[model samples]
Target: MTESNTITCEKFLPHHPAAVWKALTDPDLHARWWAAGDIRPVVGHRFTLDMGNFGSQPCEVTEVHDQRILAYRFAETTLNTTITWTLNPEGEGTRLVLTHTDFDLDSPMGRQAYDGMGRGWPHVLDRLEGVLGETPGFDEEP
Candidate 1:
């Protein structure tokens, strides 16, 4: 079977960019959507995302455009991939993009991860939108 080199998922969240930004940065809020990590937007910041049974994956912030984009080197010792999250204001909400790239498909681990993550990311994004929807005072323009 052919393995994937990257896992990309996009979703339109019915909340403002600020709200989605908060969900991406805040650990408590982020845990509700994705893995728990001290994921800040500042470049060079290092953190670990708890990938449940997959263990903690080390990550470093590689790029940041404030609330617009956040990219990082993910699972350096394992999957050795990069995960980027982009947020764009669209209509009355936010357009969120998740790109997981550089999977070493030649390796067994990579093939497993590529298959799993490809199926998993959509659920992750959906949960992100759900979390933001339930959050209070996240999208208000006050």
Candidate 2:
């Protein structure tokens, strides 16, 4: 679902939260699924994601709850938005929810990003699931 200032995408992955969390935090694995960056689970850590043609985006870790939650300020200057990942254990798999909020819909850049990301997040999550399927032991119970 997408709102004016927020885009939320949820997917059920047939993998453990630990595995899903690893894909979210591990730089190598993360790069394979999403953008490349020195992404860590530690709060206050700063990094930049190589967004292909969009250039590099600055991000700062704002919150981390182990495998449960990870929130960060994304595109600090240009977008000035927050991207949050939430993991919920469901059945034998994990329910991953991504919430991207704080878009300045009034601005041209913000509106464009909001529209683009709204359509892009699902594909990104699909890539994440594919990566998990390929990783050894990632699809197995921990």
Candidate 3:
């Protein structure tokens, strides 16, 4: 069996889980933080993210647990990786964990993506924090 690589990033956001969940599921908010896509939390729902210069990549929601977890198959045919977002309430905020797995280290595309995204996820999470801060009521108690 071929070994794969996984990228995990954790960020502490001073927001509620519901708010974080919205940022993950809401198309407009998600686009601002990451890529543009009709991303819903419904399992098996298909969508495509506009990766700009990287082109559009197809994705499908594979699992969702309300405001807790969201997992999906990303770039299904090409990268064939899974992206999972996990939200855990910690005191007055949410600790968001992003797990990107299934990178074929042997392939050039996968290796490149793994290398690039390893550095990119942090910046993306930073954008997510910025978006949450700008959005009204996201930082407040629900």
Candidate 4:
């Protein structure tokens, strides 16, 4: 029952934008929360997110703005999705916006992929909040 071809997810971090940005770009912090290690956030770098019980994606760094924006390409699946992560300062914290473009809800596989993502992202964002010891400036459904 896929309705949209693309979806965007967002979370706000209760920390300095630079700090959250570092956690996002730095391999060490990313490994602590993202997935099975080996990732760097520099433009032109290649990385993989191995979901032990799910699947894997080989992603490549596409763009960066040094604590402001990050973009990447995931080329392991049928849909060539581009992921964009943006950070913006809000008062004393930061807002993170994640847009997974190129999702095709018109296909069976695409629908499955979209459903998987729907279940996966919030858990990681919650982990990110746990890592920061505070909830981000956003609300979630029960």
Q: What tens digits encode model 4's per-residue C-alpha lDDT throughout 1-142?
A: 6566666778877688767776677666776777764666678888887767656778888998988999988754555788888998887778888887787777787778778887788788778767656434322211
Runs of candidate 3 exceeding 4 Å displacement:
1-4
lDDT of 3: 0.96
Return the TM-score for each candidate structure. 0.94, 0.97, 0.97, 0.82
Model 1, total clashes: 0
Model 1 accuracy (lDDT, Cα):
0.88
Off by over 4 Å in 1: 1-4
Model 2: lDDT to the true structure = 0.96
Can you write out model 2's per-residue Cα lDDT over 93-118, one digit (the tens) per residue?
99999999999999999999999999
Question: Model 1 over residues 19-132: C-alpha lDDT tens digits?
Answer: 888889888998888899998888999999998988999999999997899899999998889989899899988889899999988889998888998998998888888888
Model 2 misplaced regions, further than 4 Å: 1-3
The RMSD of every model to the true structure, in order and in angstroms, is 1.8, 1.9, 1.7, 5.8
- lDDT tens per residue, model 3, 3-79: 54999999999999999999999999999999999999999999999999998999999999999999999999799
Better of 3 and 4 by lDDT: 3
lDDT of every model, 2 decimals: 0.88, 0.96, 0.96, 0.74
* Worst lDDT 10-window in candidate 1: 133-142
Runs of candidate 4 exceeding 4 Å displacement: 1-3, 75-77, 134-142
